[model samples]
Target: MKRSKSKICSNEHAKFIKQYKSKKLTILFCQLGLLILFICLWEILTQTQVLNVLIFSSPSRIVSTISTLYTSGDLFYHIGITLSETLIGFVLGVGLGTIVAILLWWNESLRKILDPYIVVLNSLPKIALGPIIIIWFGAGMQSIIVMCVLITIVITTLSMLNAFQSVSNTKILLLQSLGASKFTILRKLILPSSLPQFVSVLKIAVGMSWVGSIMGEYLISSAGLGYLIVYGSQVFQLDLVMSSTLILCVLASVMYLFVALLEKIVHRRLGL
Candidate 1:
């Protein structure tokens, strides 16, 4: 009787897992179908002249332009330059932001002192600081990197700080009652609890990092997708503009997916 019951339970678990996997596959196929359908409609409209090819630019035209850039050896260089700036800025911004968050979390008085300033900086228009940044870092990669960091860091700090603070007080109190040191409480309790929030913030930061990098390129770059975009507009090559924009979307999507994959791995490792 006991063996039969155990076998029944095992079979039910297997059935549940099968259903879950099937659901995931369904969603994936649905997403792919939607994307393909949209692209087909877009191509049809442009080809039929319902959408002006010069203005809207068909998917085929964008692909052809990208192929041209690839053949000319400009595609990878522009992508590399922008990717390098974005990755560097993202790493520094997240690292420094995490450190600042830890410091603020550690010292309540310091957190209070910096909170208002952080809020003000977050609200301030970063684009207006373009001239100052150009003067300070020169009209080069340094300025572009600085722009990316500026866009990402404050947001990272605030998001992480809030995550740290939102950790349940009962958990901390229990650790305190057990005579755990402040460091121990933070290390064992707070940080662990904030992992999901950290991942969420990382996803947000990735998008902001791309925006900042592109904005900087627009202001001063001689190359990069952003530079391509600005030049394309000036030259009235709408195909070029659409191609660059498409590439940006693809790159941003890839980065977001990478972060999401990391999140899944971390959660699995942590058994969350």
Candidate 2:
């Protein structure tokens, strides 16, 4: 009887696993199908003159522009410059933000004192400060990176500080009752409990970082994808503009996917 029951349970588990895998595969297929359908529709509309080819610039035209860029060896160079600036700024922003969050969490007095200032900074238009930033950092990659960091760091700090403060008061009291030191409580309880929020912050940071880098490029870059868009507009090269925008979309999507993958890994490690 026991052996039969165990065998039945095993079969049910196997069936559940198969269904889950099938569902995932179906979702993936649907996503790809949707993207392909959209592209086909876009191309067809442009070809039929239902959409202006010059303005909408069909996928074929964008592909040709990309090919031209690749042939001229400019494609990878622009991509590399933008990618490196983004990555550097992303790392710095997240790192510095986390440290600031920790400091704020460690000192209630300091947190309160700086709370208003942080809010003011967050509310201020970052772009409005562009001229000042350019003057201070000069018109170069440094300025661009500073812009990216400035955009991302505040949000990261705020998100993380809230996450830290959101820890269960009951759990914290329990730790205190057990005579755990503040640092011990933070290390074991606060950090682990905030892992999900950290992942959420990372996801937000990814998008913000891209926005910052692109905005910075628009301000003063001579190279990079943003530069391509600005130059294309000035030259009235709609195809180039569309192609650069498409590439930016692709790159941002890839970065978001990486953050999603990281979230999965973190969850798996935590047995979530």
TM-scores of the models, in the given order?
0.86, 0.87
lDDT per residue as tens, model 1, 116-146: 9999999998889999999999999999999
Pairs with backbone N, CA or C atoms under 3 Å apart (clashes), candidate 1: none
Evaluate all candidate structures by whole-model CA lDDT and list the values in order: 0.93, 0.93
* lDDT for model 1: 0.93
Task: Give the backbone clash total of model 1.
Answer: 0
Candidate 1 wrong stretches, greater than 4 Å: 1-30, 177-179
TM-score of 1: 0.86
- lDDT over C-alpha atoms for residue 128 of model 1: 90
